[model samples]
Target chain A: MPADLTRRKLIWGGLGAAAAAYAGALGYPVYRYLADPAEEAAELAKVTEMELPEEELPAAGSATILQFGARKAILIRHDDDTMVCFSAVCTHLGCTVAYQADQDRIYCACHGGVYDPRTGQNVSGPPPRPLEEFNVERLDGKVVIRRA
Target chain B: MWRGSMAKSSSAGLSALGARVWNWCDERLALSSIWAIAEKKTVPLHRHTFWYFWGGISLLLFIVQAITGVLLLIYYRPGPEAYDSVRSITYDIQFGWFVRSLHSWAANLMVFAVFVHMFSVAFMKAYRRPREFGWWTGLALMGLVLVFGFSGYLLPWDELSYFATAVGLEIPRSLPGVGALIANIVQGGPEVSTVTVQRFFALHVFVLPLVFMGILGVHLALIMKHGSAVPPSEEARPERERRSIPFFPNFATQDLVMWLICFNVLCVMAFVFPWQLGKPADPLASAPEGIHPEWYFMSQFQVLKVLGEWIPGYLGEILGIGLFTLGGVLWGLLPLYDNTSQSGVRARHATWLALIALIGLLALTIWGYAGL
Candidate 1:
């Protein structure tokens, strides 16, 4: 029986080695969950901040284009006089999105992504994430955007 | 003796007959006895990489989704009013928050894990030739997963959910020939009304799960049939290389371990986040600007919008969407034509596809952030 076991072991030794690796591999992600967020934050520390001036935004039913942080967000005055701000990146392929004044949506030229100007909801195209929101608030007569 | 026993059993009548019928199935059919599949079979003992377990984790999450969903079902209704019932499961049902969190986070992670698995498979090129069905099934599962996300989003009945779901219904409207029909059926009208919520709720909890389960069965079967993605030999066989683990005690045991770990992680999440119920979807109030679908759909969502605008409005929307859906199908089926029988690169296709997908994802993420 011992000899037979040895023979069997020889045949399946490679398989066993691989299985051990599989078990080890499973351990790695668990490790990452332990390590990831902190590591990611450190990297994020390198990112710079940007701001937008409010007067640049057009009146009600008007739109303005501005770049903030490492990306772009569009500022618009809706019919209600309240200011709405959205990122200018298309959700589909990450193309630089443009504001479509006529259609009231953000447009991506690369793949035809269209986002609602009012809500930044994807109107059309393949962008997945909604246009990101910028932290902007009214101060006096000006709307200010915080950095990434 | 057999005849005598059979006659005696029959004399005992159908109550005894039912027990007899049940006993006839035997010890091997018992779930506890399934370990027999591994008893004498060879189970490779090599290790696996961390990434490989994402699929297993994803499956675990699905199981959580199933369990929590069923538990929630005790309280959940199917109509617009049904949403409150779902909400009550969290607020009313004992430990409902745990269950709801399990369901929500698990569903989200399942999608994430599917992406990871799919990309990993692509990086490994597991879709080659005989394994093409696996790839196709996986692709279909991906679509269904998005549907899961889409439908589940509406179940929350939040304003973001309402508008996001509305956007979800609209994406399909550009599907060329069947655009309007598909849109109407899914949306239940030209707009997202009570009917739309009802439809999304039904699909989230019922219809899509049935479809997803079927495809998942096919996907797992294919994985077992073809074996895990093989690693390149130049690196002295990846520490995680093992093709033939008995699906029982060996691989199955490992799978159980993985699930336990994932559950632990989910436990932390449920305790931490506990399935946030944002303000009940406000139809009257407009969504705050910069509303986005969850991360998973961002790439295609971004891509489709771009394509629609570039082409003539009417024509572009149709072709853009039609092409996008077809493109996904084509991507899944690509391995059918990629002959690797003699290709020495050996299982590199999956890894390559994973890389390409990552690139596309990265590019889109940048754009998504840019709101390009």
Candidate 2:
């Protein structure tokens, strides 16, 4: 009877040791994810309600970079003097492609991927699709991207 | 004579049905003793050194990762849409967070175990002689696994992933002529884009898994062919006359026990901390304060600092990258390196120490990444 109890105890002990070693191995990545930045953004994006503004248009020949809500936007004045909004995320790896005024094209420094500012087309490089476009309207002088 | 021939034909007919029809011939059939075969194949009764347990433990971790990783995939979204999907998973699914964390942790353990196993194999000069290919195979698998880690690191679409990937892409950019080209392909054009996440997600969850599985299959098959090394003992045989258990029932039972224990630990981790979803990767937002490579690559990250992007020109850089690869190939073809006999306990111990030192240095490089 004593031997049987000892054997049972041994089996459970072995089981416990194995479980602990396995958990110990997983320490680092868990620490990394807990401290990630994305969690912060999720907190920031939550809104009860936000009243967007109205403004006079910046002009037809140039573009403006906007950070509204959690999204980045490139608001361009088209040939018609109307504002068009598009997500600044490069159609490629999701890098924020910036408008280079000198070149009149959006360029991603990460991989040298370039896209057309007007059409959001992949002019040169590895973009599988064009930049995602969003509709914008001028209520007064201010511009609001239709998120809803 | 006619009656005996008829009897043999009838038995052959029974075997044709695929059931154990031969059992009916029990009366006259020549019965070879399967028990005798088992006896001949049995491992000698001997206990393994504790170090020997490391490889079994590593195998245990690998199996754990496979199970956990598969479960995590059901909730993982590997595209521009990854962040939202992961959120929904945490809130909507029962035990979603638990599963994800378990998967994440299991992957971490697997990488740790594989490295430990790898170093063990190297030190014991277990890669020597007929098993050199086995050694090389393990090494190549190690490379594939790191790639697995790097690619998967970006899948969660969190801020850390965003920054880590930005750093990760720079390694290829340091390559030379093809560096830019490779970086573009990896990024799915330019910058950290959704496709980059998608591509890495595919590689992490699908492609690398396939390749790793293939190499692993080959690795175990070769280990079986070559046999495992028995650790050095006070009552030891000369290396030349050393023998091993046939790697089946002898080691398999322990592997099972190790796996069960590892799984239980993983469960505890899942419940305690759960997998935390990071801030959604926002391109416009700058990276958080301090960013580091995933643990498995910490050593290599340290190397990059010391080595400082020394790929030379495009060709030279390619060569630099190729050197380790070349070493792997050379290591794999061990049977060819010296088919000659290496006999003695001293030689075995020396080989073991050499392999351990090499692996230890590599791990140190990772450990020192922060310093660099």
Candidate 3:
């Protein structure tokens, strides 16, 4: 090859190599990012069970707050023989729902949303879905609450 | 032995077939004439030649947005299911996050490139005489791009986008006569709802793209017809002093190299700080604290906020909207307003006015970033 042709080829080759290296440097991380899926299910699957004394459990027509994992849940003793649990977070706007003993339903203060304690169904207002229900069990002398 | 020879013969036959097909098409279409035109094109070479690359860079980013956007459309759903579908695409679908993030980032980068191209053209006075229509088309494209960003913002149906869009739609309400009507048409109802989301999705994916492509086609045709603009300084110089480099290899190679660099930067941004989907929107809930529009709209947001505080009520909104509209109109009609000849040596007063407007916008953007 001519001397000038060799010099031009060397310069172009060097620039192309540099560009390839830069692409690899940037692309490797993006490859990893696209490859890995966010593990939201695994994070939410962590279960926490808490046991409360029988006397501490709310009586019929009343409810008490309980902690499960990172969420707040309402545990209600619907009747002498029945107990139920529902997430305190409202289905409408995610505000904490308050147990209304007088109204006989759970109430969200942000909006006038109401839910049935027995079924966790949105009976009135703007809520579109029922409050998420959690598993509740009575064993021996204590009431156990498990997050769903 | 027969299988190997047959395979070799088939490959050779395919090459012959491809050549014959090319010749048949070339005979009717006269493809060589197109090649001759490309070969004859030349780009001006001067100190301000670097500015020319900005247009090409903007075009490159637009192409990137188109590709990535189509990829995203395969998985994206509009309306009530929009938020969840976006989440699923990002977290569950294979390589969906990368494609979505690339689309989002490229949209932002394209806007940035367009702004730079606009300013460079302004400072260089490339919008003179024959290029006046080209300038108008460019301004129209910029408006269309901003609309694209606004429409795309609501597609995810997240809290930030929800409130930001509410504020965005409210701006048009300050117009005197048909403000509310225009706002209603843009939003598809009295308020932002499923219908609004559907309309915005249509605008972002179908309506805006079609309009943008049409304007872009005209703008590109204008550019090619007129060739690249001569810088004001170069234009003032003697004809013998002017110089140019061939567009085929010299200018095109530089554009390609810049595009490669920009691609690397885009990949790094999409990977390192991928766009986030904020909390799902709840219409019943009040707008969240510190809610703001995208960065590109920050200046207008700050303007409205400050003016509203000072004037108190609809008056402030009208004044701010009026001022912003006036600025936009002035920018669009700049060539007509300032009739400096193409080969003039002295700078026009309009150039100073443009510089001041640019500085004012930059200051407002900074103030918005400071969250004041």
Candidate 4:
């Protein structure tokens, strides 16, 4: 009886090991295939700087969204002659936030989330964090925006 | 003495050797048990017996698709060269057009067959009690088949394919907060491009087929375990009056005949109306007039369009999507609603619901085409 029990255990254990090996053999290639190829990440990382034509920049107290390496960034020229730039994506849900000149704040129309236009800080609503800030400068009459 | 002499004869020696080999394999494999199971299996016969052929027909069409799809993949590239490769296949390669047309036709036929089979099963109350899981797995298979159609529709990369995909993405894009994000991830960017094509290719060729086969295996196993369902009407009859034929030879033979008929129809369609390819997609050009998705999606497309116009904002789009999703969920939950109550009042409600849903789909589809 002991000999028969040992034989059964050996066979079952061998079968279980084979099944796991089979699963791994099929899984590894599928994982490699489905995973992000990182090419898009590389492209996004490649663009550390974006330049917008100075003429295209919005007037004081207004803002315009700029294409910044697979994302949208807002460039605002305040009434006080101070300029600030931040990602337009809402902190709560990825909706693009727009500057509301009347309220002097950036507003996510999607969920009514509000952010401080000058400091890029979430002020109210569903937003849990501040919008990412970008470095902005005037270079050769172009509004140059760089990752900060 | 006569038996011993016969066993020593030359022909008897060959027969003995064959029997020995069969016995040797049977001792290890137990093959006869499988044969016994097949012999014992039977299919129910009734006025609705014709519907049973449809599920088998869908399987037959899927086999055709698998073969022709593999053949097309040999030359069809999925990225920027997609259009050119398809163009070459249509005009350059020998018999390529035929194979492509066959695959396309088979896909459409398979979807049609699966739908018919599902509705027939619903009306038959085949989802009762023990067979509930079979219905669920079958629904999953149908969903996979629809995705297969959606993904394959975009592979040609023509103007129609490109515009259709863009419009189709709008369904997912209209969802509230992360709608656009979901759409972006699916298309691999803000718009349908080469990356979208590659993503769809991988899905259509690899991921979908693997998942489909897995689900299909379970579905067939469930069918084998439970056997063919008798319609509620037939089940009302006396048990002694009920009749069925063995699955091994009689029903299997009937299934083969149905497959042949299906093949004949498929060939006629493929040859009579070969699939066409429009001009390659131009991303910069304004979308041409009458941009629409495939016929299967027309109902939902029209719903969104009409509803969007009526409500005139995000609210309308959300309402349309919400209603459609609710209908789908209810449809998937039919088995849960009517389990073990084939003759109850709930069964009548289920039947009426199926009828209304079917008519609604047909009407919406027709309305969509007319508006187009």
> Residue B355 of model 3: what lDDT?
96
TM-score of chain B of each: 0.79, 0.75, 0.93, 0.95
Best by TM-score: 3
B163-202 per-residue lDDT for model 4 (tens digits): 8899889889988889999999999999999899999999
**Local distance difference test, per candidate?**
0.71, 0.67, 0.85, 0.89
Q: What C-alpha lDDT does candidate 2 achieve relative to the native structure?
A: 0.67
Q: Per-residue lDDT of B126-155 in model 3, one digit per residue for the tens? A: 887789988999999999999999989999
Instruction: Give TM-scores for every candidate, taking all chains together and pairing residue i with residue i.
Output: 0.60, 0.58, 0.70, 0.69
> What does candidate 4's lDDT look like per residue over A59-126, in tens digits?
98898888788788999999986889999999898999999989989999999999999899999999
**What would the per-residue lDDT of candidate 2 be over residues B297-341, giving only the tens digit for each residue?**
675555554455554344554554455456556445544543434
Q: Where's the lowest-lDDT run of ten residues in candidate 2 chain B?
A: B37-46
Off by over 4 Å in 4: A1-148, B1-17
Best by DockQ: 3
Ranking by TM-score: 3, 4, 1, 2
Off by over 4 Å in 3: A1-148, B1-22, B342-346
TM-score of 3: 0.70
What TM-score does structure 1 among the candidates reach?
0.60
